[model samples]
Target: MSTREEILGAAQRRLNLDPTSSMADIAAAAGIGRATLHRHFSGREDLLTEIGARSLDRWEERLDAARVGDVCSSDDADRLRATLVTLLGQYLEDSDDFGFALTDQFVLAEPTLTARGEALAEREIELFAAAQAAGVLRDDVSPRWISQACYGLLVAARDALRAGDVPRRDLDTVVASFFLHGAAAPGKPL
Candidate 1:
């Protein structure tokens, strides 16, 4: 990788461990001097913007690779559920600096970044709507609601993984069950 890429990679790794980490921390992690880090990234905001863009790119690539249309055609609900599991898994496994910064409060607060996030979210909702129209997903649930629920599942799973409360291997099944069926006990109306 180029020096800039290496620095970005290092910064991203530190962000994963602690989103609030300073430039000094990133420099140390990257094994470079602070001046060198600054040469590549003039400031924290500059670095974060790059990371945010990169993260969005990675998400787009993953979404494309999933071939969502094929799965949706086979079984819309299952496809939607599987797509979410895949996304969460990608977030958990990604080593890019942008992925790490995704957990940061500042990143979430940035209007541009948040807008990009929302656009990605809307894509997921479209997928849900496709499933709903196919009758695999409950017609009573709105695409917006299901999209929010899907995001909630990802956040909860991430927190659970960080807390060591849930095993990583169980994430896919857990998320799938919740989205496909829901948490209400059997015989109870949803």
Candidate 2:
């Protein structure tokens, strides 16, 4: 891999483990000198912006692969559920690649990242709204709430995996099921 790519990968892993890591810490983690790291990225914010952009690209690709937009607009419950499973599965499989963007405050605060993230989230909210209108999702809760809840679930899943509270193999299934069905047991009162 190229040095830039290597540094980005190493930095991402390091940040995932600790969001408060310094640029020097990232340089050390990347196995490069501070000067070399600076040559590639102007500073920590620059590196984080790059990572955040890449993360958004990955998420957009997954959304497209799952054909989420198409499924959301349809009135078919089966398709909606299936698409959600596919989307969640892909996200879980790619957790390591995009986890940092969701958790890193600096990345989220970047102007470019904020704009791109809000755009993506707007699409997601529309998707949920369509699903709600189609009877695939509950109508009581707002679509915006569902979108935000889904994001929260993903963050929770990442934390759970890091904490070893959820098995790696079951991460996708656990998250998909929880999002679709909630924590209630069958025939059990809420």
Candidate 3:
């Protein structure tokens, strides 16, 4: 891997473990000297800004892969297609760093991170609106609220997996199921 990629990877891991970790700490974690780290990234904030941007960019890609524009076709069918399930499953499998940055107090407090969160929310709102218009999702609840709740569920499932409360293999299933059906049991009255 390139030095920059190595530093970002190491930063993601270290920041996830402790958002308050210093640049020196991250350098040590990355097995590089402070000067080398600084050469790649100006400082802690600069590195964090990049991390937040990269994670958000990844999620945007995932959202596109989920095919938000396919709401019409999905609603024309009786059930949601596998594309959504597959996309969400990938989110659960690969969004650990994204989740980590999102849940971190320090990261969330960053202005750039907050802006990224807003953009993410807007993207989700668009997706939800498309689905709701097609009758694939309920329109009674605000899309923004539902999106937030769904994300909360994803993060919760991620934490459960991290805490060993649930197996990693089950994380995707749990998140995807909750996103599609919420807490309603099969054949149970909602």
Which candidate tops lDDT? 2
Q: Give a tens-digit lDDT track for model 3, residues 21-113.
A: 899999999998899998999888788888888877888787677665564345643334454466567767665766677676666788877
lDDT of 1 by residue, 72-174 (tens): 6666565665565676567555423244554667777788988988887776677677777767678796889976776666667667777887787876677
TM-score: which candidate is best? 2
Q: Would you list the rank order by TM-score, best first? A: 2, 3, 1
| TM-score for each predicted model, relative to the true structure | 0.81, 0.92, 0.82
| Better structure of 1 and 3 per lDDT | 3
TM-score of 2: 0.92
Residue 132 lDDT (model 1): 78
RMSD of each: 3.1, 1.7, 2.8
Q: What is the overall TM-score of model 3 with all chains considered together? A: 0.82
- The superposed Cα distance between candidate 2 and the true structure at residue 50, in angstroms, equals 0.7
The order by descending lDDT is: 2, 3, 1
Query: How far is 169's C-alpha from truth in model 2 (Å)?
Result: 1.1
